[model samples]
Target chain A: MRFRRWILPGILVIALAITGVWGYNQYKIKKNYETTMQNSYQRMFYDLKDHVENVQVSLSKVLLADSQEQNVILLSQIMQQAYLAEEKLAQLPISHKDTAKTEKFLNQVSDYSYALASNVLEGSPMDQDQKDALLKLQNYTDYLSQELMGVHNKLTEGVFNIGEIKRKEKEDIENANDNMLNVRLVKLEDKMTKSPELIYDGPFSDQVLSGKAKGLGDKKVDIEEAKKIAQEFTGAENTESIEVIEEGEQMDKTAWIPSYTFSIPKESSPEDSPIYIGVSKTGGKVVWMENSRAVNKPKISVEQAIEKGQKYLVEKGYESMESNYSLQYDGLVLINFAYKQNDVTIYTDLIKVKVALDTGDIVGMDAAQYLKAHHDRNIRQPELTQSEARGKVKTDFDVDSARLAIIPKEGAKEYLCYEFKGTYQGGDFIVYVDAITGKEVKILKIIKDENGTLTF
Target chain B: MKKAVLILSMAMLVTLSATGYYLYINNQNQNNFSSTTEGINSVEVSNAEKNKDGVEESETVNATLAPKVLYWGSTGQDVKDVQWKLAQWDYYNGAVDGIYGTETYRAVRAFQSKNGLGVDGVVGPETAAALGLNFGPVDGGTQGAGTTAISRNDDIYLLARAVHAEARGEPYIGKVAVAAVILNRVENPSFPNTIASVIYQPLAFTAVADGQINLSPDADSLKAARDAINGWDPTYGCRYYWNPATSTSKWIWSRQVVIKYGKHWFGN
Candidate 1:
């Protein structure tokens, strides 16, 4: 009886304690959840709002701009911005059913904006239909911005409590990285290299040498046969002065790169002798050829020829050159020089040097092989003055700006040149003039409105 | 004295019985409430027992929560083609594995970033719906309600196809030209608000036209496209390419020439 009398009171006190603890936990959880939701909503809302505003600003510029090109660009911008904003908005797990209407409204804005931009990019003249669509889009974007602002205000005021849920959603997102749409493509290639093979079609019967033809190394070139092959390839008129030299002791392992020798009249000087050089990877036919005055002459000793060639290169303003050990072929000695110009180092392997037949003194050198193999290189140099070279430009163009830079030229090293930048009829152009000669060399223009622009 | 004792014991027993009855009724009510909360009906309990004849279906379901068909073979072409296609979406998911896995999915998600589509990893009906192309039936063993499971290699292939069609013959320089053009559009008074909108606003790229952008790309094209995204601009500063051989459009070529690449010349 005594125990029973006290048990009821103890039980009442325990129940009160349990109720208090449970109520406290509920309040804490509710607060945390609300905070999470608010944060997510704020982030998403702000992002969407910013995108919409950007579109609005861009579109406004185009709508008010005088240039038709600018308007077209703005139209594209409007669609892109609107679409991005809507996509982001859709990512949010909004419990508010009313937001569905907002989404539909955003879709409408997207359709309208895209249609207008597409027409503009296609160079279609803007008409009343486009203008009406654009104006409506602007108004719709304004409404969206205001709606997001209201949501932001409510969030700040602590009106909701679903933050924990939102946080969990974000966690799911991080877990589902595979769901990401940003695909980076990795290119896989064959580990080994393959040479391009072009089949050789025949040139058998009797024909005369007419057009350009190349020679293969060690794989002897029968001059009579080569003449016919050239004639068949180009269908050009005939030529005569063809000769075949004796096979040397060292046969090049590769049949592609061949060395050949031909003589001009004894009366022709090294610089005046008309020489033809051709290159072909195939044994029979040439793919590339060039005709130029011979730069090297028959010489005596290899050592004498190399020394003399070095002297000529030095006098021609080349400094700090690296030379290859002498390579003797037939009756001539070949020496190579790798020369440096400013920041660029040029490798000229075919500096075929020659010594005089009588005195054995160094006499001739060739840079033909090196020039044909090389391309204009990239190098650093001092800036040039565009102002001085501006006199050469035509008065028809309105020059906007001028700059000094290194301009690339074919068969030449990069040089400090004057670049004159200007606009003509709304087109951007850059005119390059040689700094030393004040000669107009190249004209490059930057095309505007190429990718199609996005507006409000 | 005996009468008084009996009266007290009876009163005690009556009180004890009343308390026991109250506790029993409360326990029964609690059990009912719990069953309601859990939504576990008696019929379901019977079904659960039957299913657990030997192996537990519940346990199996819990163990294999991940969806089947984890791999998506290349969506288009071969491995090389898939690599190129993925490159277009700006997702360098590595060499096309021809298997759909985490990398491919991540790449797909990233691609969706610039698109106005939901960034769900599964290429679901919504994504397929948005693509709006008549892609032949997917080759998975089963067609789930939402996303069809694809091999990683298949994803790579599909991605490659898209990249190739969108950006073949376009080197890093071409990519830069394309990027510059996009930027120019952004800065211009007219154009779309975001990059995604511009690329996907429909009928923009030739690849996107006639559903070619949905195909896979080869390895070479993929590398070229990637280099472009990395800021290689071969176009220098010119934009616009139209094949003189096939282009019927009259206005694109009318612009002044700014530069040339391969066979096409770009102008403003």
Candidate 2:
């Protein structure tokens, strides 16, 4: 009797203890779930807001393009993004009726924006009415973006306690360590220094530093080592002397980077181990360095690269020749050439590249490669007379002007062509025709409708 | 015998009391959980409503609702097919994914921008979108989902095309937006405008910023195009649109709202 009594008491105590533990665990689980859910929702909201911002940016581009083609393409893209953003927002399943209503409003805004773009591209006539509508649409989208920004800020500040729906989610946090926003811009004062046509100007040069590189490692440049390496490459005094002008960071927390400026002899070339060496400041190791490959004998000069580009085309039989127009992109030179064949004048662009003046080596050639790779193409000469070609223009089009020029065709031939531009059929049209054969070669049409006016 | 019975009854009473306590706590927890879930749903709904309030004014502003039907190109047939194709790519924003709506127009523009097409936002020949290629025609098993279908290589090509289309005709910023538009379409439902679909829409993007979509896209273009598509978007909610030159589009005035970015305005 005593044993039975004791066993029953013990069982009662155990059961109570188990219940208490279970209750605590449940509380903890619920709390955890709430946190995760809240976080995920907030992030999703921010993502949606960001997407809306992107749509505004795209539409802005359409408004700014100068070419008819650019405007059309940009308009199309704006409409696409606007609707997509609306759909994304709609999928959130936010239970608040007010929020759903707001989403619907945004959707309507997107629809309006898309409609304008479509009408404009369709050659619809543009009047003050359309302009006024576009202005309103533009303003509304901006307001929406601003409003969303406000919401995002509030969420970030914990203004809304979405604690019940909290849940953990994997996030792709941008590693703050991977920033090199301290790069600076410097002019290459020395002619012998040889600046590359394509410069790797890091984000730092533009002052677009977001300070996102928290806990980032120092720049990946070994100042002392890079100076030493630079001396060897430039044949400077002491073969290790370098003046550090600036320092920077790159690839997150991995390295320290620095930029140096110096004056080397005019005869210095990339013939040595390295003319210039970029090193990692953190580890005092080299990350990048240039070698002697850029240096060659009188193998190719800037002028020679241009000549070669032209000659390459000539070898393929393109005649009516001229010269390179100008140089750009640091070391890139644009060559303009003309040739006459079969009573026609052909104009073409030839691009030539010289890595550095100090090395006199050709680094790239374009026009020649293009001509060689693409053989003379067969083309059907237009058969319409100038009058007939002009007649093909719509009646509403008004003739602005006309010109006669020699045009080059792909078959190593030239043709006398007439270029006519006018407003026809209530739209602008630019037409090209063969003067000798009186055939229509090309036609560009620009339409003006309620949506807007297009210019070619 | 009486004392033993008393002890047994007392034990039974204790057991009953403990069981009752356990049940009470369990019921309380369930109630809390259900209440919290309801609260979460309510919160989400409220937040969404708050988000949409800003664009409410523009829809009724000029309100010149035109015919919804669109003539995408000369024959209109290409636009129809392209719209359906875009639907497959998940860019369809309307009923058939084929019926061109305001959303479809936006997606077409984004595609043009990605493929170096003209910024006219139309699916004209010069803005020839990319043509779908059969990788299998050259090598079997070389292309598949997540493997060859619009992979990094294609991204680069599309990016280059966007650069050509947007940057060539407009300022560099416009080109970036053009790039962003393509990227936006990749995430939007109104466009057949997957990063790949919009790019390969076939003659839909001819004036790629370079006035030639025929230019072989470079690796940088592909990557940038993809990045723009995946990264920062410029057309999130904006549906109606206009460039400054075409600011006179009456349809735009019909839209009372405005969302500004860089140099253009997007909204109804």
Candidate 3:
């Protein structure tokens, strides 16, 4: 009793209340963590369902499309959908071993569609076997979409329990979303593996594995020279007054370039916004530049904006650059251009030009990709004649125009191929027939999305 | 009734032990001179002094943290650590493979030559301190823990990632500028106070929207993040930056740009 003056019931009550409150606080923290984790899992499941639906819908659209442009668009949409679905699927409780086939299926869909779309973008035609494969893919996606929607419906109905699903995982029993997932996803993936094997020298091919910027040569320029090149590249009137901000051979160990960065003073507001330009140390060319300022008001149409962008490119000596696509974002219309050499388009040399709708002036232009990839490519003569290449395309393709073109293989290498633009099964496609082997190398289904013409 | 009394006594014992522990910690904190700078260790100092080989101990040791000097022909994590910091600052151009090769030695010499360390190409503790690697685990006591030092590991990682994503290809200073902007925004009234909040704010950074923020931070980005947190405001309180060459946001143009570092122009 001497240990506590208030060794009474009141003291005991106080201590008990404190412990109770502290315990409650701890419990609340635990609850919050659990709820947040479950919510994330729920959100991921919902997103996966949506992406799978999109993949199915895109496949269906591909089946419906009759134009090569629409096929290109559809395939890209499918690729994006497949990638998103794969990402969401990985975030779920399902084991990686259980989902490996599904993941590989998604990967191939994205990679194959991308290769095919690139083939078309370079003006190739799709063969019948590719179309057949696409049709088969469409069927499996249909099955997946419906099954995924059904599972989502069950999730909405509280048919699956999150806690129970986790508990079942301990016993190595299939639970949570596994049954609903494996039932359809595994079958769909299995079907995907049996489809026609597409062997193309796309960016993903092992043969195309190289990270070196082969186009960037040994010529080096100092900062002062780089600054001059920068001012001209940025179209700045005052060359000397433009502040040289930073100069370096490489930004980091991984980056492969020496460049000088410069700042251009604003006319009205010296500090309002900053404009910077990067001139490459090699070949004294502009590598990267950016100008950020809000547009005033919408005054110019997209047509005029395109014209202005092209005009700017032409004036800046981006000779033979053709406007390939346009994307509208915020208040600006960004036009993507590809360089053409000797009547054959080089898709690797891409430049983006952004035109403000309000002023019809070129507000943004990023030539980093172009400068890194562009070089005087000695495009080889195709081993196969246009007619011979056409013969190797999907036998059912209504072959249109075939031409000799060189396209980038894996961003590091170039391959000359015969580009054939045509339609198959009332759906438009471009299938590239390898110039050397007379084999159907790549196929593309084209579609036009909201922003502009894009290939997967 | 006996059980009730026993429970009460146990609770009393717990409360008394808690109070004693609290007081012990509080007393230990007050005993230290200050954490922001080095405090003279009063315990067994004469013995420490005797072991220094006639070298006098520096007064401010806690303020600076640097691992043991890494030398050429030495291959370990420490060498890779300093090499990364050097690479981030544009002093080193070779891969951070942890082997202190000739390139790494040259980089160490350059970094030392610039930082006023001995130009002998050896990465002594002094140079390591400049590189921001810790000499040892910093005490998180009640004394001033140094405002420049970050406490949370995740904050350092997030800040470093933001730097890498936002200014990966920019010059070393540009990476610093990007990190500084985040810190500056943390202080600015209009922006969020936390690094994660300021960085993840919708439309604040293009890297977040583009998912480039997920890229792992290189050594330079990590160092830039550390430098920014350590009160290195290379952007000088500028709140915004964008490459005028690629950004179509005419709205951002209205802000006054203080200066340009690398490809980015910092604006207020």
Best by lDDT: 3
lDDT tens per residue, model 1, A1-456 = 878665655554555555556555555554554554355445655787798788767756766766667776776776567766755554444321213344434544555555455455546666765565556556555555655566556556766432333334345533222221100000000110111111111111011111112112235565555655544332334535443322222212211133333222222353442322232223443322222221233334545555666775665433455453343322333345554445333432223343343344433434333433333445444334556688888776678766555533322234556666676555556677777667676665432211111110
Where does model 3 exceed 4 Å of error?
A1-219, A247-254, A395-402, A421-429, A445-447, A454-456, B1-268
Report residue A264 deviation for candidate 2 (angstroms). Answer: 99
Q: Return the lDDT, model 2, position A51.
A: 69
Give me the displacement of residue A404 in model 3, in angstroms: 3.5
Taking the tens digit of each residue's C-alpha lDDT, what string does model 2 give over B1-268?
Answer: 7567557756765675566566556555445544433332332221110000001111111111111223453233335555654554555545543445677777777766666756565554333324232111111244322122111223444456556644444422234346665544343323322344444322223342113454444323432343243222233223333465644334345543333333554442
Candidate 2's error at B213, in angstroms? 49
Rank the candidate models, highest TM-score first: 3, 2, 1
Give the alpha-carbon lDDT of every model.
0.42, 0.41, 0.62
Q: What is the interface RMSD of each candidate, in Å?
A: 31.8, 25.0, 24.5
Among all windows of 10 consecutive residues in model 2 chain A, the one with the lowest summed lDDT is A179-188
On TM-score, the leading prediction is 3
Query: Is 1 or 3 the stronger prediction by TM-score?
Result: 3
Q: In angstroms, how far off is A432's CA in candidate 2?
A: 31
DockQ for candidate 2, please give it.
0.01
TM-score of 1: 0.24
Q: Among the candidates, what TM-score does chain A have in each?
A: 0.29, 0.33, 0.55
